[model samples]
Target: MNTKQKVKYKKNSKKKMNWITDHLFLFPTILFFLIFILYPILYNIMLSFKKMDVSNFMTGGVWAGLANYQAIFSDPLLYKALLNSFIFTFACIVIEFIIGFALALLFRQKFPGVNFMRGLILVVWMLPSVVVGVLYKWIMAGDSGVLNFVLTQVGLIEENILWVSSEQFALIAVTAANIWHGIPFYMIILLGGLSTLPRDLYEAAKIDGANGWKSFLKITLPLMKPTVLVLLMLGLINSFKVFDLIYVMTGGGPLDATTVIPYYAYKLSFLQFNFGEGGAVSGIMLILVIILAIVYLKLMQKEEAN
Candidate 1:
């Protein structure tokens, strides 16, 4: 407790206080996450192992220990829904990327009303899924729908096609609506990535007598790889969790054709009152998303290191 010792103790105390103050700023966020996101996920996992329904949901139920998961595996409907989900996600991602990238490139150039056009396109993306679903549902109606009338006039078919009600086209209709809704998101992300590319590289490429395609293949694609990867990963996760759109558009389909995993879980939980199985489905989806998210993080780390 001499002069030097007293100063040293005072500095240590100040450092301790500073550390506490810094971490206190994170307390609210951490507590919010623990209470909301983490708690619900943990509860869902626990519910999957129990024999609970609306009957015993409030009281909780006896531990069933994998029965729900076993039932999920045994059901043929789950496989059908899973396959449908894969097809829907694949179609939406591919089509949206192509159209969105093209639009992004188009909008990046200076043109009359270019800013206004870009903002207008975002109106579709900003809409709620339910609203988009309803809009498409009407446009795809069987008898007097605009789509049917136009196709008939163009001689694409002799009669109106059953877009939403028919098993053959229900899934396609849902996929098309989703593609339109998601294109703006892809456009904005890819446009941001495009904006960051070095102008010097393009100038250099042009001096080397490289054509537009050549420059794009050589410079643009290579530079945009990280952004493309991240966008695709996000799109896949969002597509997998699609529910509200499907519910509003087709209500899981004419014959389960558009019933993706999320809708399947909802059908089980609310429609059938099988909470255990529904929770199991959610747990499975959560695991799949977590795995993909881990891969996304690893890829990001590698990109940063490079």
Candidate 2:
């Protein structure tokens, strides 16, 4: 080969080798995702369309073709699960956000023992959901619970209330526990966002005769929008997937009052050995979460464009 041709061939070979090496480095991560995430998702989607029970799961059961979906749609339990999931998710996020934002604002100011208090508050959030569930379950026990004892002593109520065992209070009890466990996460995230705000903006506002509330309304909220939106989306997804706490505390009892989507899916798949129906329920949840995720992405894109 001519000298120039040989040089070009060498360059092309080097480029090919580099490309191969780069892809080789990425292969492990790609393989992991395919095996762990993508495969399970596709498999579950397929399972949702099949008539699979514990006996037929290993044999690649009969193709029911939307029968599972039809059954799930017609089941009143599905609607109840959806409602509980929505109520739990909405209540947790709203209460957690409000309390967390307030805590963030409070901790933003310089004070003695503030760092210590913040760390202490985070200890609650750091605890495992199972542990929190057990702890609250004990505290909210009807006859001998601390909550009932305190309320009675304080004259709030003359009789012990069944917090976890009663349908009316089971959802509220779980939500309150979730809120306590979630608030520190929101507080830490909002505090980080607050730290990024320009101090000079506050100074300027103050010079313009803006009060604390006015400055917060005009500057803090606007500047924190992106952070707030992301946190809210994450909180929504996390809250919707809650299972361990409610399962530990209520076991979806008191007439399925606390049976959210995840728990319902678990009940169908594991408890009833109805994998097809369970897969259908899970598929529905995945679709709903994906829709929210798409909305979140669109909002982020719009914010970036602006």
On a 0 to 100 scale, what is the lDDT of residue 5 in model 2?
100
Each model's lDDT: 0.94, 0.96
Model 2 alpha-carbon miss at residue 83, Å: 0.7
Residue-level lDDT tens digits of model 2 in 122-229 = 999889999999999999999989999999999999999999999999999999999999999999999999999999999999999999999999999999999999
Give the alpha carbon lDDT tens digit for every residue of 27-89 in model 1. 999999999999999999999999888788888877999999999999998999889989999
**Model 1 lDDT, full chain set:** 0.94
Clash tally for model 1? 0
Worst 10 residues of 2 by lDDT: 53-62
- CA lDDT of 118 in candidate 1? 99
Clashing residue pairs for model 2: none
User: What's the TM for model 1?
Assistant: 0.95
List of clashing residue pairs for candidate 1: none
